[model samples]
Target: MLANPALQAFSMFLVGTALTLGDVHSHVWARACWCLTDVLFLMAFVQWLRWPGSYGRKLESIWYLRWGGRVSLRKAAEIVYSEARAQESVWAHAAERMSLDKSPDGILCYIAEVIKQDTTIYGKRPPSTHVEKLDPLQLKYGTVTNGAREVRMRDNAKTVFTDLQVDAKELRRALHEVRESLRTTMPI
Candidate 1:
């Protein structure tokens, strides 16, 4: 119907927004309608448009940076962790123990997960964590939506981190073993 100007005009007439050529009107003549889809398409075809870069593209591109490599991921995670820890709140401490994943996917997931927790008691259930695969094409060209507003993952294996338990006795044993090994191998 949109392809047929007559049909479109008739529809517009039914909607009372049609203004045809050679049509004479009274003192007041004003009509408006939404008929620009084709015009928009034509304009889109006529222009050389640049698509947007994804939020993760830059991070991913520098993933294999010859100088720092994966150190970048770890460092970014450490900064995120430190900032949260510096909040000095119970939630901050708990987030500290989250054992955040130290990779590109991990950092994104961590940020998205962290900001999802609202500081309100509105009785609204927090949105559950969701595992969503990122499309390679979309990740290459399209922008990521709300990466820090909700907890989203590419897959179960893409989880930002896991809740871990600390065992005091096990920690002490590991430290003692490390100390003994270092003393015996002393280059110091």
Candidate 2:
């Protein structure tokens, strides 16, 4: 972000020189200016770090990447498990044991849809329409971006996302167990 290395170096040099000069008039103003410069640099640095294109964005991407793979793994596991479960209850649907009431692929597809929606909302893909625009108010601000908002909204959003993550993992784990049990006859 700081493309002007010369300026940054000069400022650092000035600050250092000011620190060592130890003069009343010149040093005072120089140190004051240096302090001001440092504050400005710090703020800019903070902003850059928080920018959507910076490490902040990268971190978010990484999280989603990990979560996405986990979600996929969960989907894979679900497929395997569901097959095994289906085999056990081939005569009668095991709707009771698998009380989830939703197919693994169905949930994965739904989650995938949500991910697509999130990406579109967050501008991951090209915006399709104005109504599809993301509301900044929806972001999990405290964990990701610091914003002024009532506790309820943040808490609610965090809870929803957390639930989604947990459900995805649990479903995936079940599928993984199923896959492990029937490894030899795995469909795909």
Candidate 3:
């Protein structure tokens, strides 16, 4: 976080300008340095929230903001999607899907205990990722957080998250499906 040169320079410059813009002699030079440090720390924490962090961290942050009661579910998903697109490695790739026992959002997923809620998704039970091939399950139901605010993008009409979900029922079924269809494979 401290390695961001642009952020460091900007925070320093802003603090310096503010101090100098007023009566310079009113504040000690050493005090100004401390002020700059404080500003830098504050900016760093605030800016850190914008970074596309590790998958779980990023998911939790977005989920936190989304369910923070500040915006609607669709609006939250849209906000996260837009911010993710601006980052280098985008949030959730739309092309591929993985099927196994459970989604990455398992029992202990939420960042804060306070955020653990049964309102939208059950946090206590390990969610079932399995489903019939009729339609893609909402990622939220599976405790995942990439697709829509609902987890697996349930209503593509609501959010832009488009993570594909293939129903890999069993090993033999998966093998047969793989041979039958040439699907793009993604890393686990």
- Highest TM-score among the candidates is held by which one? 3
Each model's C-alpha lDDT?
Answer: 0.33, 0.39, 0.38
Task: Give TM per candidate.
Answer: 0.20, 0.22, 0.26
lDDT comparing candidate 1 with the true structure: 0.33
lDDT of 1 by residue, 1-188 (tens): 35554455455554444343435473134244334434444444433122123436434423423233122222333334433433333333444355265544444445334322211101111232443333333233322123222222355443332121112232233223323332212355
**For model 2, what is the alpha-carbon lDDT of residue 68?**
53
Which stretches of model 2 miss by more than 4 angstroms?
1-13, 16-19, 22-25, 53-188
Clashing pairs in 3: 138-152, 139-151, 139-152, 140-150, 140-151, 140-152
Count of steric clashes across candidates, in order? 0, 4, 6
Best by lDDT: 2
Tell how far residue 55 is off in model 1, in angstroms: 16
Instruction: Give the runs in model 3 whose Cα sits over 4 Å from its true position.
Output: 3-68, 88-90, 95-188
* Candidate 1 clashing pairs, residues 3+ apart or interchain: none
Task: Work out how many backbone clashes candidate 3 has.
Answer: 6
Model 3 TM-score on a 0 to 1 scale: 0.26
**lDDT: the better of candidates 1 and 3:** 3
